[model samples]
Target: MSLWVDKYRPRSLDQLSFHPSITQNLKALASTGDFPHLLVYGPTGSGKKTRIYATLHELFGPSVEKLKIDVKTFTTSSNRKLEFNVLSSPYHLEITPSDMGNNDRVVIQDLLKDVASTEQVDFTNGAGNGSGGHGGPTRHRFKVVIINEADSLSRDAQAALRRTMEKYSSNIRLIMISNTTSNIIPPIKSRTLLVRIPAPSSAEVASVLAHISKKESVKFTDSNTEPFFEAVANNCECNLRKSLLCFETIAMQTAQINVSNDSTSIIKLDWEVIIENLAKSIAGNRTVANLAKARVVFYELLSHCIPPRVILKKLLFCLISEVKPSMATELVSIAATFDERLSLGQKSIFHLEGFTAKVMVALEK
Candidate 1:
């Protein structure tokens, strides 16, 4: 069975329920034969990718949905083989250069060059030439190259991309998705049309949850189901993806006879629960034993592929509520120090454990 996130996802600009103003603007951009490169920035679960796809649908129709995965390999200067999967259709291609590590510059430059060298063709019905030959009446003059996690791209890759963006403006349009734009350099930022999609409000999230709940036949044991949805919306911190997953988990759990509709029964993501427990432990006590336990948990979370920065951020969020109001500022400053370290330094475990130890000390005061 498909996940609810995918099953109920808005397929086109018109289908998007929230952010009507942004939807209207995107539709305006898509109405034309050409538009500038788009730098789409938003928080997680804020529907950045969904909006990008919807815009693509407006430009190329359902043909963009017929995607195939292609794995391309590039040989580095050290003769190392780097391979990553590319999602592509006749009209567009998507890639995450962050996956290529330090070699991202090579991938970005070479890949964009190759894609831009060829002119785009429209094979959809009357959009293409009658002979089905190279000479075709193009529905759109450019192919889209979607760069996911554009903020995580290396400086070298971004530098190379700035030049390539101008050179290939004719044959390609870039749609870059990122959580924030602080990491993106000014040159590339200047070249693209920036679109910011904020997280939906609690009411928006609750409304969506209510619709999905009705469609899925989720039954609330209590007479007043409003609180259930509102509680869920708040608990998820306005993240639509987490709200859906949490709601689905509760629905499944409540199906087994005699389930309570209280907020305490809400099922949080496993990693979140782990971090919450760790925060409580640190807040209550500061000892070698507690620190040792935290180190083990840190390794466990890292092994499970949870990013160190996310671990630190969630830890702070949980820790802030446990400590006195005066401590929140100090805690945030400490987290900021380690957050930069996590970005610059190689060993994330050191920063993660360091931040926890620091928090434990502050709580001890």
Candidate 2:
């Protein structure tokens, strides 16, 4: 159950909540037989990749079929004899997303360069020459390549990619995922279908959480589930991952215990503690002392993969709840500004510091 990342991913498009319009848009493209390259932009863990891959699977079935039928149809090859090509020949191409600097367009282009150079053969159906032989008519397929964090793509790298996208638009459908459409280059942006994925609505997010709780055999009351879900959603800024993690944390710490007292803190982390801790981290306090404390708290909050934007806003909500009404509006404004930078992939420690200072100063007065 600890491996909930894989365990709980929405297996079907219907399993994804509150983004029906976006899913419908993708569904339309998938069914159309003319899937222009797509940029599925949204905050992290908001189901961009899941939704696209779900559409791919719904259209093509499995990974094998996706690589073969869709990609193997690109037969514009110049081989003399024949080449046998496996769907994932050399079979190791994968896109791993992380905050590391290794994520750039050069690496993406290099990977494409390797894929484009490979040959496909149909020796089984026709007479073929030796290993270096390029003989009969061969069939090749277009490939689907995804850049998980497209917002992280460097400016120069994106420029390089614009040329590659134009060059291979026929043979490849490039899928770029980001938190916002603005981060992408206008030309690259122009070429692809844009699926704007929104955060899950409160009702939609709760329905799924309720289903999960029931599956786990945890008996959360109907009344309590909504409040908890709503609270976490607001805290995690409507990020699906964080909302799920809130349930998981309580479930784990309590031995997956079914508790009617969902009001009690399983991790002993009340909203007040959360506010103060967020303030500390936001106040330029990423020190060993702060981080050591933060890791346990952060992980507890993050296991569900909630978007960072959600968490920051929730922290603001907590601050607002604790602060005077006269200053609540100002703090809320600060939270929004902070989240905007975060979604753009700007490190928020500095912005957070300013936000926390304002909150703390406001609190002090």
Candidate number of the best lDDT: 1
Candidate 2 stretches with Cα past 4 Å from truth are 14-17, 64-103, 117-140, 221-225, 255-262, 265-365
The C-alpha TM-scores of every prediction are 0.90, 0.62
lDDT by residue (1-365, candidate 1, tens digit) is 98898899988888888999999899878765568999999999999999999988877778788999999888888988888899999789999998776688889988889998888765453353211122225546688999999988888999999988999888999999999998899999999999999999988988898899889977666656666777787888889998988788777765631234365446667899999999999988799899999999999999999988799999999999889899999999999999877766667899998998888877777
Report the poorest 10 consecutive residues by lDDT, candidate 2: 68-77
Query: Which lDDT tens digits does candidate 2 get at residues 1-365?
Result: 35454577765565666667776776666554436677888775577767876766544344322343122121112422221222342211235223423344445555565564454333433223212122233212345666666776667667877887777766666777888876677988888878777777766766777778777777543445666655555655566776677667766665544334545322333644775666556444435565456545555555555445556776776666555689778887777776656644554454555555555555455
Residue 328, model 2: lDDT of: 76
lDDT of each: 0.85, 0.58
Q: What is the lDDT of residue 82 in candidate 1?
A: 84
